[model samples]
Target: MTKLAHHLGCFLREHLPHERGASANTCDTYAYAFQLLICFAAKRMHTQPSLLEIDQVDAPLILAFLDHLENVRRCSPRTRNARLAAIKSFFRYLEYHDVSCLDQARRIQSYR
Candidate 1:
């Protein structure tokens, strides 16, 4: 189980700024979306966000989170899609560092 903290740090600090060249607003938005995801996952798993494993963030959970973003949080479809894009980006990063999650990453990328 790869540590969410380390990978997240690399994504935010190195990947987003350097590799992707994301703007400040995009980075902030992605950060917020991930913050929500961590909270949601931690609550569901009865564990701390720092301890969350890659395997814990499976497709079913992601689908549920997206639904929650729309139905519960009242986010617009555009907002939901943007959040999904951020998640997909993170999963893509996981593809290289954590091949164990390649199928999961592909599944997320192919999500409608």
Candidate 2:
């Protein structure tokens, strides 16, 4: 289940279009968000993002990513918060749908 990219991409292509009529922009946004997530998690695990394991990403890692987005990326707080919101929502959806992300869903509550 560590293949978040393949899983998410398949899920989106198969279900999202039918369930929510997802737009191209929405798909692309989610893709980029996950890319950033993987990179951030990889940095925490001291490896290249492509070598990251999904288990390396937890609550603290997510917070660090948000911080990096705000401080290093120089993104506005509002934008950072919005991306966090989106990430939280995605995990929530994953958990609710019996996806293998329940261990990470609780981190959403820690998000501001």
Candidate whose lDDT is highest: 1
Residue 62 lDDT in model 1?
97
State the lDDT of candidate 2 residue by residue for 1-112, as single tens digits: 4755555565557555666677888766766777787777766678876555544667888888988998899999887877786677567666766456676777665678
Best by TM-score: 1
- Candidate lDDT values, in order: 0.91, 0.70
Q: Candidate 1: where are CA atoms >4 Å away?
A: none
Q: Candidate 1: how many backbone clashes? A: 0
Native-to-model Cα distance after best TM-score fit, residue 36 in candidate 1, in Å: 0.6
TM-score of each: 0.95, 0.75
For model 1 the local lDDT of residue 83 reads: 92
Model 1 lowest lDDT segment of ten: 1-10
